[model samples]
Target: MIIRTAMAQINTTVGDLEGNKKIILSSIDSARSAGAGILLFPELTITGYPPEDLLLHTGFLRDNIRVLKEVEAYTTGSDTMVVVGFVDFSLEIYNAAAIIQNGEIKGVYRKMNLPNYSVFDERRYFTPGSRPLIIMSGSLKIGVNICEDIWVPAGPTNDQAIAGANLILNLSASPFTSTKNLTRMSLLQTRAMEYSCCMLYCNHVGGQDELVFDGRSTAIMPDGHRIVARSFEEDFLVIDIDTDQSTRYNLLEGKRKGYCKKAEVEEINVIIPQRKHQEFLPEETYRVSSEEDDLIDSLVLGLRDYTKKNGFKKVVLGLSGGMDSSLVAALAVKALGKENVIGVMMPSRITSDESKKDAVELAKNLGIETFEIPIESVFDSINGLMRPVFSDRTHDVTEENFQARIRGIILMGLSNKFGWLVLATGNKSEMATGYATLYGDMAGGLAILKDLYKTQIYRIAKRINEQTGTEIIPRNVFLKAPTAELREGQKDQDSLPPYEILDGILRLYIEESFSLDEIVSKGFDRETVEYVLRLLQRSEYKRKQGAPGIKVSKRAFGKDWRMPITNKYRD
Candidate 1:
């Protein structure tokens, strides 16, 4: 027997019930047209992943179930069994997958593991299931599970396999990180080999707030061969799996592992007739993307989805010709196109001629709309008004930050008048150390590089120029020393350490959670480590008020780093 399975890696909007219904129905039609015996979709396909507090509403849950029933009605007379994710409201709500066939729900599989770690609060909304589910279609025994169910070593997948399941179907909304796909693939392959079954993994695609899901939905064969879908984009993949191969491997493996006669699990038998083997072209394994490519793609998708979903067609950013803003401008153009990106150069008296030249050069190269707003007169006017209050104080960081706040005001004014979303340019290095001024550069609707360190910004910039085969970001932007140019002859290194060293210590402390002494043991200066750690803690309040940004790293500041603003513990 041959089972033709279709995995729809889809992009869904939270609380968009009608929109999600259309997508799910359209995908079901496409799958049925391809003669797939079974179809799989990503987790939370009806309501979207991480619906957050929206789940608290009773009407939202009822509406989601209504959409699921509509889907069930649409699948009437079709032999294809659809496994779709939705919120099930029994006595209590559950993160669930409903197995629909022949116009009625055959069975429902509630998620066993509720992940409550970084970016996930499933435990708050869902009741974990204690029973494992297996679907029986003729000789094929398939296991159905949700995301995070198969991640554990001894999760429900173990029970389903012991019950003689030859195929495992997992629906996921796994968020994109730089190195997460590699880890996910390895885990899937290990499960396939150990269980003597093919693993079908479907993940959501597109950005929801700061979380972007890279939909690399894959089919891992029992022999460890994989057929993958697209990355950072929605894709529909259909593949034929030979049951003979799986059955043979399962027989040997199950007997070797001393398979039990009565496995503790629930079984739902559905009559899904096997479709005739349609010889389609073999699917090639997706090419391994370079780290630069992954980072660029994730950022572009995140920005594009956020802007579009939020109903903004244009984006505005302050371009200072420095690395952070310049790189952000380039990415904005890539995501929203040159016509929709507005580059505003709000130069004050201290702004250098070289900086002005670099900013203009970048705008011209990228062909984005440019606005040269000189803020010196405005700065002087504000300074004169504050001269009496500042009579006791001399020139210091206060005067320097006045310029940044002025530029921020201009950008916000443009955004307000033109309905353009302001994209904050501050990266993780500045955000981590509280180097950015509140209501100043940190003022925006979205922060593009909040999860990325300063050194990582330079690397991405280099990669952009290298791939485009042109100096799109300008050569001088890379050559010039980093600076805010708020005062005369100022460089970032004057206040903060070199990015190479600062970023190294930050990675250890923030991502690795290394203590001060442990970080110092990694060859960093003790004083510098202590200073960086202190700045990180001191800046927690600032980060709480900053714009939400895309998360492309293992640990982002939002939702991932949860430190109290008034904590007194010093490391």
Candidate 2:
């Protein structure tokens, strides 16, 4: 008999029980209509994944349990066995999964492993379960584990397989990083092969704060082969599994479980009258599948979710007609609607005519609103104020910083009056070398492009325009030599090395966490490396003050990265 399973890749918000319940019920109904015998959900699909500090509140945990009971009551008459993740409050709190068959909960599986390091903090909230849970269906014996359980080589799945489990279900809320799906598939396939059991792995999808869960749920045969895989986005995947003639089913173990349960306890035995058997052909189990879209989809989704969920109706950008700000404005328009984005052209005396003209043309091409705010007056006012303080010294970078501060205060005023979220457009190169002015251009409700390198920003911008068949980002921005335009002849190359050279070293030193001597030994000039390293070290405080952006890469300036501002040890 072929047992059909549906994996629901549902996106949930933390603490939104009513909404989560509606979604869960809808998915179960969908799966049932699709002829699925059982439906699987991700870890904490009810209260959402990584409820974080909310788990610390006792009332919150109580509410989670309350919803779980309500959901169990809602499913009493349904034939579909729905497996869902929740927080259970018994004598102690448990990260749990309830197996609901025909509207009543048959069994529950609490998560055994609690990840405490990196982005996970499950150990801080609840006590780990001591054992694996195996539920006895009419014909199929299913074992269950939570997110971090089967990722290990010697976890509960192994023990459950030893105890004669024919199939294993794993629920998770694994967040996306670089090449995470590849690693996940490898590990899950390894576990399936090692345990010789049909494995079903499900993960939640969507963005919650800085975290973006990539929902690539799948069902695998025992021989480390994929039966079917779910899509990355919100998907409802159903696959047929023939337990009797399935490739992964162990006949000896299935017969052994039919006779006994444990060493001492009585086996869970049920008497069902036999029905007439019909000749059967093996169901078609497809091989491994792949959905490889361009890398831009993830960046676009991450940006879109982060902006919309945060409740920002409109975004304001400081477009100097420069590469960074222009790319940012284009991305903002792409993420949010073009009408929702405003590009402000703030020009001082030092701003070139091409910069002003390009800004206007770019705004026109994108069909976004634009405003010209001349900062020459503000610069003159600030300079007049600081003239007496620096009576003897010639005009310097501090003078140029005044122009940026004026623009920042103006943006803040607009933000205050219009309730628009400001998107800071500083790139990783500028942010790394303290080349940016804190509380100046750095003041914003969100920093959309902070983590991206200068070269990467240019690349994504060009690719966007090329793909769209329109110049969303004008070509002039890319062609022009990058400049802060703070002074008359100030250029980026004059202050720092070219982005091609700088970001290359930065990729190894910052992102890869290479040591100073190690970076210097990679054929870079030692003095330049030392200077850039020092600048990066000193600019942690600047990064701390910048607005939080979507973490597209492995590490952004948000929660994923942590750097000390005051440190004594230096190379």
Candidate 3:
């Protein structure tokens, strides 16, 4: 009556079928060696999570099925029942999981709920599945469902449970967003207690472009005891659960809930051969990571994967001695090693001595190579070239932007000559309000802090220093006024409100989706709120052109925010 289950919390690249196949096969062998009765893999194990437009290709779909078949062959003669996710195209494409045992696919459970909110766009590609699946393995009746299915009420889990399922297995590719892991575990615990069954959840780990999946795959027993895998990394978790200990039969008195009739559920029977396996006590412990730890780890993983997956071994960033650039440098060093990170100081006449010293000190502390490419001569040449057309025009924001563009050209030039990936240091607040000069400071392959607000950037910067046990980010960088140094004595607060106030309004307007009046009502000045919203609306075009960055918030600018550039209506 005891069942051993294993979950492979693995990292997969989108569209890398051959590579994913190797990982999946190795995981299957490991799970079989562990003597697991059932093994679960993350959703979209073949094609990787959120394959996006690649799913539209007919050949890709066939190739995914081919990989699944290949994996199925590896499970031949093994007692472990493998449930791995893949794309299924019967009449139409469906997000599905194949149940394989003894080299044969017992059943395929198509994901019933296709999420279409925020970062998820599954409904656009996948047709909704109607049938709820249950696997009858000896005395254990386990319900199988995909990510969104378990999140929604009255979904496949409920139907399968009503039809006498005592254990629920979920294969997920849920992306990291601040404290989503805690919320996910709480949901699983609630479901386990409600159904008087154990909830086994497996999630994808590592970064895919902007999305970083924290693979804290977990199991919640009916008694609320929890067992978890590694956080923000690949981990193989194996655990045992006694079917006799489940309270489902006692709660239902050996009768079905009748909410879903026996005929309504599609059942597959698999006979797992009883074998002598080593018994180990389940580690009923979950690693509870703080928001700071999760944030830093998510950023590092996202940056590392993005760089390596894109075929870039080294990264270069313009070090302005500001908080944003310094943090990005530290992250790049951590992700790609200090030898691969090159910090360039493109100082102009307006750049402060303190800024120059701060940038050098930071590079030294991080043990990174530094280059001081002063842009004064380049700025003069650009001005001389422009003075003919602008002989009568007065010096204004145009001159300030010229300096920024000159520095941008320098960074891009270094990137081209040395083949270094340029990292943009602009944060969410600057990206939101039109505070960044287009084609200037925003010129990079990836924007490290694109989705983070200015205040959040400061907090993260402080936390990095604390975690490293040294001032790698430089102590003076934290106290100095945040400035682009585009002009003499140009502080960010001069153009915009204080970060504390600006971030407060932005959190309400952007993330919380509050109206101008609504934000103003929440202890903010009406004029300031209106101005900030207007700036945000004006900056839509710039954000659309910027590089994609890690999404660690409830709503990021890339996939989540979809504002129009030619809109006339004002909030």
> Clashes in model 1: which pairs?
none
Ranking by lDDT: 1, 3, 2
Residue lDDT tens for model 2, 97-184:
9887765777777788898755777888888987777766666667788989998666777667766666788998887765666778
Can you write out model 1's per-residue Cα lDDT over 142-259, one digit (the tens) per residue? 9999999999767888888888788899999999999888899889989888878778999999999999999999998777789999998889999888766677876666632864
Best of the two (1, 3) by lDDT: 1
Top model by lDDT, which number? 1
**For model 3, which pairs clash?**
none
Give the lDDT of residue 145 in candidate 1. Answer: 97
Which regions of candidate 1 deviate over 4 angstroms? 251-263
Candidate 1 global TM-score: 0.98
Q: Model 2 off-target regions past 4 Å?
A: 90-92, 223-232, 244-295
Task: Give the least accurate 10-residue stretch of model 3, judged by summed lDDT.
Answer: 254-263
lDDT accuracy of residue 205 in candidate 1: 97
My TM-score estimates for the predictions, one after another, are 0.98, 0.88, 0.97
Ranking by TM-score: 1, 3, 2
